[model samples]
Target chain A: MSTTARRSRLHRQEHLTALAFVALPVIGFLLFTLYPMLFSVYASFTNWNGLTAPVFSGFDNYIAMVQDPYFLESMYNTFFLMLGIPIGLVISLALALAMNRKMRGSTFFRTIYYVPVISSIAAVAILWQWAFNGDFGLINQILALVGIDGPNWLQDTATVKPALIIMAIWKGLGFSMLLYLAALQSVPRHLYEAAALDGAGAWKQFRHITVPMVRPVTFFLVVTSVIGGSQVFVEINIMTPTGGPEFSSATIVWYIWQKAFDNLQMGYASAMSIVLGLMVFLITFIQFRLNRRNQFSID
Target chain B: MSSQRVLPSPPPLKPERNLPDRTSSRAASHTKTRTRPSNSERKHRLGNLIVTIVLSLGAVVMVAPLLWTFSTSLKTREGVFALPPQWIPDPFVWENYLRIWSAGPLLTGIQNSLIVACTVTIVGTLFSALAAFAFAKMRMPFKNVVFLSLLAALMVPFPTLMIPQFTMFASIGWVDTLLPLIVPFIFGNIIMIFFLRQYLNSVPDSIIEAARIDGASFLQIFFRLIFPIIKPAIAAQFILWFMAVWNDYLAPIIYLNSPEVQTLQLVIANFNAQYAIQTDYPLIMAASFVALLPVLIVFIVFQRQIIESIALTGSKG
Candidate 1:
C-alpha cells in the first residue's frame, strides 16, 4: 500500500478501535443511568405501585409532593445537615494549615484524624448510636463530668439535627482536610516568601496566598458535600431507623426510600426523586455560576 | 453519575501569572531571610510547638470514637452501662469477637462483599482504563461529544435512579443476588475513567504514535505501553473504587433481603437492628468493627497514596 493510503487506513482503524474501547461504558451508561432516568421521569407522573402497570395521572404526584409536609420536613432536615459542611470545611482548612507547618507527628495526626473518614458509615453510625445513648453513652458521661447534663441526643427533636451535624463533621473532617492540605502544599513557597517581602502580614499572606489556592479545593468540597449531603441516608437509617424522634432527622433520600420500599408508594417516591435530582443539579449550577463570577473578579 | 459534580478545573490561581512582583520579591526575601535567620527560627519552633499541642488534642477527638467502639466491643453488657463508662474494657470479654461470626450472616456478608467488590473493581478498572486510553489518546469521530455525554451521566444522582434501577434489575430476576451489584458496575466507573484519562494526558503522543507505527494494535499498545504508564493512577483509583464498593450500603439493602446474600454493611446493619432491641451492645459493636476492618487495613497501608491522589484530584476536581 502507498504510505498515504496506509496512513488513512490506520486512521480509520484507530477510529473504530477507540469506539470499540468506549462501547462498554457507553452501553453501561445507557442501560443503567440514562434508561433508568427516563423511566423515572415517566414513573413520576404515574400512580403505579411496584406490582401493577403504571396509569398516567398527569402531574398529580408532583402536585401532591408540594403539599406533602413529610417531604418538606425531610428536605429541611437535609438542608439542616448542610450546616455541617461549612463548619467542617473551616475546621478542615485550619487543621490542614496547622499540619502544613514544619512539625513532627503530622503524619501521625493525619492518620488519626482520617480514621473516621475511612470508617464505614454503617459501623460509625452504629457506634454513634451507642455513644449518644441517653444516660450512659459517651457524650452524656463527658457532659456530666463538666456538670452539664446532655439530653437524649438521637431521640430529641431539638438535638437530633445537631447530633447528626456533629457526627457528619467528625466523619468528613479528614477527607476535606486532606484535600485542603494538598491545596496548601501547591501554593509556591516563593509566592509566600514574596508576599512576606511585600509587607503582607501573616494573615494577609494567608488571605491572598492560601485562600485562593485552596478555593478550588473548598469549592470542590462544598459541591461534593452537597451531593453527598443531599443523599444522606445510611447514617440516618442506621442511627435513627424510625427517622429520628418525630421524624426530625429524616432526609429526602430516607423519605424516598421509605415511601417506595416500605410504603410501596412507588410513583410518589419517583416524583420526589425527580425533584431531588433537580434541586441538586440546580444548586450545583448556581455554584458554578457564582464560582465563575468569583474567578472573573479575581482575574 | 455521582462522579460528575467536581469539575476537573486546574488550580486557577498560579500566583506567578498575575503576581508580576513575585519572583523578584522572592529573591529579595531570600537575602533578607539570611540576615534574620535565628529570630525566625525561634518563632517557627514556638509556632510548631503550639500547633503540635493543639493538633494532638484534636486528634484525640478524631480517634476517640473508634477507640470507644473497640473498647465497647470488649465490654460486658452491664460494663457498658456503668456510671463512669470504661475507656478501656477492663477484664475484656474476647467472646464478642468470637461470637460475631455466628451472629447473623456476618461471615457470608463479608464473603458477598468481597465477591462483589473484587469482581466490580478488578473487571471495572480494566474497562475504565481502556475507555480512558481511548478518550485520552486515540483518534475517534466525535470523541469529545461522547466523553462529555459520559461525564453528563454523573449529574444524575443515584437516588434519582434507584427505584427505576431496582425495577430494571427485578424485571430481569437479578434481585436478591450479588449480580445486581456486580453486573451494573463491571462496565466501568466514569470517575475512574476521567481521572485515568487526565493521568494519560500528561504522556506525549509521540510514544503512542511510535508504537502504532511499529504495527502495534490498540489493545496491544494499551496493555504493553499505556497500562504500565498509568498503573500508579490505576492503583490509586483501584483502591478508591474498591473501598467504595466494599463500603456500599444503600443499593445492597435495596436488593438483598435474605441475610445470606447481604453485604457486610447490611449484615452489620441487621445486627444493629436485631441486637439493639436486646441491648447486645458488645455484639453489635463487634460486628460493626469487623465490618470496618478491611477498609481500615487498606487505608492504613495505602494512606499516603490515597491521601495524595484524593488531594491531587480534589484540587483539580
Candidate 2:
C-alpha cells in the first residue's frame, strides 16, 4: 500500500479500538441513566401505580403536587435544610482559612474534621439520634448542666429541621473546608507577598487576596451543597422514621422515596422528582451564570 | 527497548521538585527583611496560638460523636442514658460486639455489603480507568461530544430516575438481587472516569505513541503503560467509591428486600428501629460502629491520596 493509504488504515484501526473502549459505558448510560431519565419524564405525566400500565393523565400529577400540602411541606423542608449551606460555607471557610497557614498539627485537625464526611449516613443518623434523645441524650444532659430544659429534638416539630440542619453542617464541613484549602494553596504566594509589602494586614490580606481567588471554588461548593442538601434522606429516615412530628423533616428526596416505594405512587413520585430535578438544574444554571459574570468583572 | 528509549521520564517526580521550590520561595521572601522583632510577629504568633486552640476545640466537637458512639457501645443500657453521661463505662461490656453477631442478620448484612462494595470498586475502577485511558490518550472520532454528553448524566439527580429504574430492574427480576447495584456501576462510573481522565491528561502522549509503535495493542498499552502511571488516582477513587457504596442506604433499601441479601446500612437502619424503641443503645452503637469500621480504615490508610483527589477536583475545575 502507498504511505497515505497505510496511514488511513492505521487511523481506521485506532478509531475502531477507541469505539470498543467506550462501548460498555455508553450502553450502561443508555440503559441505566439516559433511558430512565427520559422515561421518568414521561411517567410524570401519567398515573401509574407501579402495577398496571401508566395511563396518560397530562399535568394531573404536577397539579396535584402544587395543591398537595405534604409535597409543599417537603419542598419547604428541603429549602430549610439548605439553610445549612451558608452556615457550612462560613464555618468551613473559616476553618479552611485557619488551617491554610503553615501551622502545627494541621493534618490531624483536617482528618478530625473529615471523619464525619467519611462515616456512613446511617452511622451518623443513629449517633445523632442518640444525642438528640429527649430524656437521656447528650444535648439534654448538657442543657441540664446549664440549668436549662431541652425539648426533644427529632420529636419536636420546631427543632427537627434545626437538628437536621446542624447534622448536615457537621457532616459537610470537612469537604467544603478541604476544597477551600486546596483553593487556598493554589493562590499565588506572590500575591500575598505583594499585599504584605503594601502593608496589608492578615485580615485585610484574607479579605482581599484569599476571598476573590477562591470565589470559583466557593461557587462550586455552593452549587454542590445546595444540590446535595435538597436530597437529604437517610438522615431523616433513620432519625425520624415517620418524617418527624407533622412531617417537619421530610425533604423533597425523602418524600419522593416514600411516595414511590411506600405509597406505591410511582407516577406522583416521578412528577415530584422532575420538579426537584428542575429546581436543582435551575439553581446550578444560575450559579454558572453568576460565576461567569464574576469572571468577566474580574477580567 | 525502542519504546523505553523514546519514552520521557515519569511525571510523578515533578510534584516533588515543585514542593520544595514553593516552600523555599516563601522562606526566601520571609527572610528578605530582618531588622528587628516586630509587634506584627508577636501578633502573628498570638494569632497562630488562637487558631490552634480554635481548631482543637472544633476537632473535639467533630470527634465527640464518634467517641461517644464507641463509648456507648461499651456501656450497659442504663449507662448510655446516665445523667452527665459517663465518658468511661465503669465495667466495659464486650457483649454488645458479641451480641451484634447473633442480632438480626447483621453478619449477613456485613457479608453482602462487603461483596457489593468490593466488587463494584475493583470492577468499576478498572472499567472507568480503561475508558478514561482512551479519552485521555487515544485519538477517537466524536470523543469530545461523547464525553460531554456522558457528563450530562451528572445533572440528572438519582431521584429523577429512581422510579423508572426500579421498574426496569423489577421487569428484569433484578429488584431484590445485587445485580441492580453492581452491574450498572461495573460498566463505568462517570465521576471516576472524569477524575481519572483529568489525571491522565498530564501523561505525555509520546510514551503511548512509542508503545504503539513497538507493537503493543490498545489494551496492552492501557494496562502496561497508563495504568501504573494513574494508579495513585485509581487508589483515591477506589476508596471514595468503596465508601460511597458501603454507606449507600437508599439504593439498597429500595432494591434489596430480603434479609439474606440486605447491606450493612439497611441492617443498621433496621437494627436501630428494632432496638431504639427497646432502648438497646449498646447494641445500636456497636452495630453502627461496625458498619463504619471499613470506611474509617480506608480513609485513614489512604487519607493523603483521597485528599489529593479532592484537591485535584477543585484545582482542575
Candidate 3:
C-alpha cells in the first residue's frame, strides 16, 4: 500500500478506537439518563398508571400539583429543611477556623468531625432516631438532667423539622469544615502576617482577611449544600415513615417517591419531578450569576 | 485573587493609640519570639489552650453518636433505655452482634451490597478511564460535543428520571434483581469520567505520541501508560463511588424488593421498620453498626485520598 493510503487507514482506525472507547458511556447515558429525562418531561403531560396506556392530558398534572396539599406541604417542608444550610455553614466555618491554626491533634479532631460524613445515611438516621426518641432519647435525657422536659421530637409536628435539620447539620458539618479548611490553608499567610504586624486583632483579622479570602469556597458550599438539602429523603423516610405525624416532614423528593411508587401516579409524579428539576436548575443558575457578580464587584 | 487585590495594605508606620492594638502587637511579637518568654506569650498560650479545649469538646460531640451506637449495640434490651442511659453496656451482650445473622437478612444484604459495590466499582472505573482517555488524548469527531453532553448529564439528578427509569427497568424485567443496581453503573459513571478526564488533562501529548511511535496501540498506551499515572485519582474516585453504591437506599428499595437481593442499606431500613416499633434498640444498633463497619474501615484506610478528592473537587469548583 502507498504511504498516504496507510496514513488514512491509521486515521480511520484511531477514530474507530476512540468511538469504541466512548461507546459504552455514550449508550448508557442515552438509555439511562437522557432518554429517561426526556421521557419524564413527556410523561408529565399524560395520565399513566404503569399498567394502562398513557392518555394525553395537557396541563392537568401541573394544575394538580398546585391543588395537592401534600405537594404544597412537602414544598414547605423542603424549604424549611434548607434552613439548616446556613446554620451548618456557620458551625462548620467556626470549626474550620478553630482548627485552621497549627494545633496539636488537629488531625484527630478532623477525623472525628468527618466520621459522620462517611457513615451511611441509613445508619445515621437510625442512630438519630434513637437519639430523638421522646421518652428514652439522649437529647431528652440530657434535657431532663437540666430540669426541662423534652417534647416528643420525631413524633411532634412542631419539632420534627428541627429534629431532622439538626441531624442534617450534624451529618454535613464535617464536609463543609474540610472544604473551608482547604480554602483557609490556601489563603496567603503573608497577608495575615501583614495584618497582624499592623495591629489587627484576631476577630478583625478573621473578618477582614479570612472571610473575604474564603468567599469562593463559601459560595461553592452554599450552592452544593442547598441542592443536597432539597433532596432530603432517607433520613425523613427512616425516621418518620409516615411523613412525620401528618406530613410535617414530608419533603418534596419523599412526596415524589410516595406519589410515584405508593400511589402509582407516574404522570403526576413526573410533573412534580419536572417542576423540582426546573427549581434546582434555576437555583443553581441564580447562584452562579450571583457569585459571578460578587466576584466582579470584588475585582 | 480579586479579593487579594482589593484589600488595602498595612501602613508602614502607624501610631498605636488603642490598648487592643498594643495587645495585638504584643501578641504578634510573642508569636514571633523564639527565645525569651513574655507576659503576652503567656496570654497567647492561654488563648491557644482555650481554643484547643473548645475544639476537643466539639470533637467529642462529633464522635458521641457513633460511640453511642457501639455502646448501645453491646447493651441488653433493658440497658438500652435505662434511666441515665448507660454509656457502657452493663453485661456487654455479644449475642446482639451474633443475633444479626438470624434476626434479619443482614448477611444476605451484606453479600449483595459487596457484589454490587465491587462489580460497579471495577467495571465503572475501567470504562470511565477508557472514555476519559479518549476525551483527554484521542482525536475524534464531535468529541467536545459528546464530552459536554456527558458533563451535562451531571445536572440531571436521579429523582427527575426515577419514574421513567423505573418504568424502563420494569419493562425490561430488570427490577427485583441486582441487574438494575449493577448494570447501569457497569457502563461507567459520568462523575468518574469527568474526574478522570480532569486528571488526564495534565498529561503531555508528547508522551502519548512517543508511545504511539513505539508501536503502541491506543488501548495499549492507555493501559500501559495512562492507567498507572492516574491510578491514585482512580482509586480515590473508586472508594467514593463504592461508598455511594453501598449507601444507596432509594434505588435499591425501588428496584430490588426481595429481602435476599436487597442491599445492606435496605435491609437496615427494613430492620428498623420491623424492630423500631417493638423497641429492639440493641438489635437495630447492632445491625446499623455492622452496616457501617465496612464504610468506616474504607474511610480510615483511604482517608488521605478521600480528603484530597474533596479538596480537589472544592478547588476545581
Candidate 4:
C-alpha cells in the first residue's frame, strides 16, 4: 500500500477510537451534570419550595441571601474553615522538608501519614466526635494530666470551629505533604552539590535552590487549599448538628445543604452556591495571576 | 562502589599525614576531622526526625478515634463513659459485633451499600475507562474543544445541580429505587475519565497499531490489549469509586428513603433518629467501626497503586 493511503487509514482509525471514547461521558455530562446545572440556574430565578411549581421571582433569592443572617453566618464560618489551610500548610511543609532527608523507616512513615487521607470522612468525623466529647473525651483526659482544663469542644461556639479546623488540618495535611514531597524530590542533586561547593550551608542551599524549585508546587498547593477549604461541610454537619452551639460552625456548604434539604428552599440555596462558586473562582483567578507575575516555575 | 569509596578521601587528606604515635594519631585525626556541626545540619536531621515522629503521632491520633470506637463497642453500656476511659475491654465483647450482625436494618444497609458501591465501581469504571480511552488514544474530531469544555463544566458544583437532578429522577418516578443511586455512573465520570485519558495517552501508540494490524476490531483491541496495560489505573479508580459510593451521604440521602435500600452511611446517620436514641454509645461505636473496616481494607490493599496512579496522572496533566 502507498504510504499516503496507509497514513490516511491510520488517521481514520484514530478518529473512530476517539468517538467511541467520548460517547459515554458526553452523554452523561449532558444528562446528569450539565442539564442539572442549567436547571438550577433557572430554579434560582424562581421562588419555590421543592414541592411547588417554581414561580419566576427575578432576583429575589439573590436579594434574600444578601440580608440573610444564616448566609452571613455561613460565610463567616467558611473563613474560619480556611484557618485549616495555613495550619495544614505549616505542618505539612515542615513534614515534607523533614521527610525529604535520608531517614529510617522513611517509606513506612510516609505511608502512615497518607493513611488518614484514604480513610473515610464519616469514620474520621465520628471518631473525632468521641475524642472531642467534653466530659470523658481522651483529649480532655490528656490535658487534665498537665493541670489544665479543657473546654467543651463541640458544644462551645468559640471552640467548635477551631476543633473542626484541627480535624481539617490533620486530614488535609497529608495531601499537601504529598505535593510538596513530590516537588522536593524533583529538586536537582546538582544544585545541592553546587551550593555545598560554594561554601553555602544547608539553610542557604534550601533558600537559594530548593525554595525556588518548589515554588510552582507551593502555588498549586495554595490555590487548591483555598478551593478545598472553602467547601468545608461534612465535618461540621456530622460532628455538630444544628451547626454547633448557636450555629457558630455553620459553614456555607452546610447551610446550603440545610436550606436545600431541610428548609426546602432550593432557589435560595442555588443563589448561595452561585455566590460561593464566584468566591472560589475569584480567589483562584487572583492566585493564578500572582503566580504568573512571579514567574515561579523552574521547569 | 569504588567511585564512592574514592570520593571521601579529599576531606580526610590533611589530618592523617600528621600522626606518628598510634594513640595520639587517632586522637589527632578525630579532632581535626570532626567538622563543625552547622546549625542547618542539626536542624535538618532534627527536622526529619521531628516530622517522622509528628506524622506517626498524627497517624496515631487519626486512628485514636477508631480505636476509641472499637473499645466502646466491645464494652457494656456501663463502661461506655467510664472515667479516664478504659483503653480496652476485658472480655472483648464479641456480642456487640454479633448484635450488629443481627440488627435487620443494619444488615440491609450493609448489603445495600455494598451493592451500590460495587455496582458503581464496576460499571462506572468500565464506562469511564472506555470514554477515557477514546479521549486519550483516539483522534476523533473536535477532540481538544470537547475535552476542554468537559473540564470547564467541572466548575459547576453538585449543590447547584441537586434540585434539578432530584426532580428529574422524581418526575421519572426513579426516586425510590437504587437506579437513581447507581445509574448516572454508567456514563463516564469527569474525574475518572480525565485520569484514564491521561494514563492512556502515555501508552505508546505502536502497541495499538500492532493490535490493529492483527485484524482486531475496536472492542477487541480495547478489551484484549489496552485493558491489561491500564490495570493499575483501573485499580486506583476502583478504590476511589468505592470510597465515593460508600462514603456518599448526599446522593444516597436524597435518593434512597426506604429503610430497606438505605446505605451504611445513611444508616449510620439515621442510627440515632430511627434505630436507637439515648443511644448505646458502645453499640454505635461498634457499628461505626464495622462500617470503617472495608474502606481501610481497600486503602491498605491499593495504597501503592493509588499513589502511582496519582503521580502518573498528575505528570501527564
What DockQ, on C-alphas, does every prediction get? 0.60, 0.69, 0.50, 0.43
Task: Please give the fraction of native interface contacts (Cα pairs under 8 Å between A and B) kept by each candidate.
Answer: 0.82, 0.71, 0.71, 0.55
Q: How accurate is candidate 4 locally (lDDT)?
A: 0.75
State which candidate, 1 or 4, has the greater DockQ. 1
TM-score of each: 0.94, 0.96, 0.93, 0.87
Point out where model 1 deviates above 4 Å: A1-4, B1-35
The CAPRI category of model 1 is medium
> Which candidate has the highest lDDT of all?
1
Error of 3 at A100 (Å): 1.1
Q: Which candidate leads in DockQ?
A: 2
* Tens digits of per-residue lDDT for model 4, A16-104: 77686688778888898888877787888998788889999999999998899989998988897887787788778777787766656
Q: Which docking class does model 3 fall in?
A: medium
The residue-by-residue lDDT of candidate 2 on A10-129, one tens digit each, is 988998998888877888899889999899999999999999999999999999999999999999998988888999999999999899766578889989999999999998999999
Q: Over the true interface residues, superposed, what is the Cα RMSD of model 3?
A: 5.5
What is the lDDT ranking, best to worst? 1, 3, 2, 4
- Per-residue lDDT of B217 in model 2: 89
Query: Which TM-score value belongs to model 2?
Result: 0.96
The worst-scoring run of ten residues by lDDT in candidate 3 chain B lies at B11-20
lDDT by residue (B191-309, candidate 2, tens digit) is: 98898887777787878888888988889888777777777778888888889998998889899989999999999999999998898999999999998998899899988778777
Model 3: per-residue Cα lDDT at residue A27: 96
Better-scoring candidate (TM-score), 1 or 3: 1
Interface RMSD per candidate: 3.4, 1.8, 5.5, 7.5
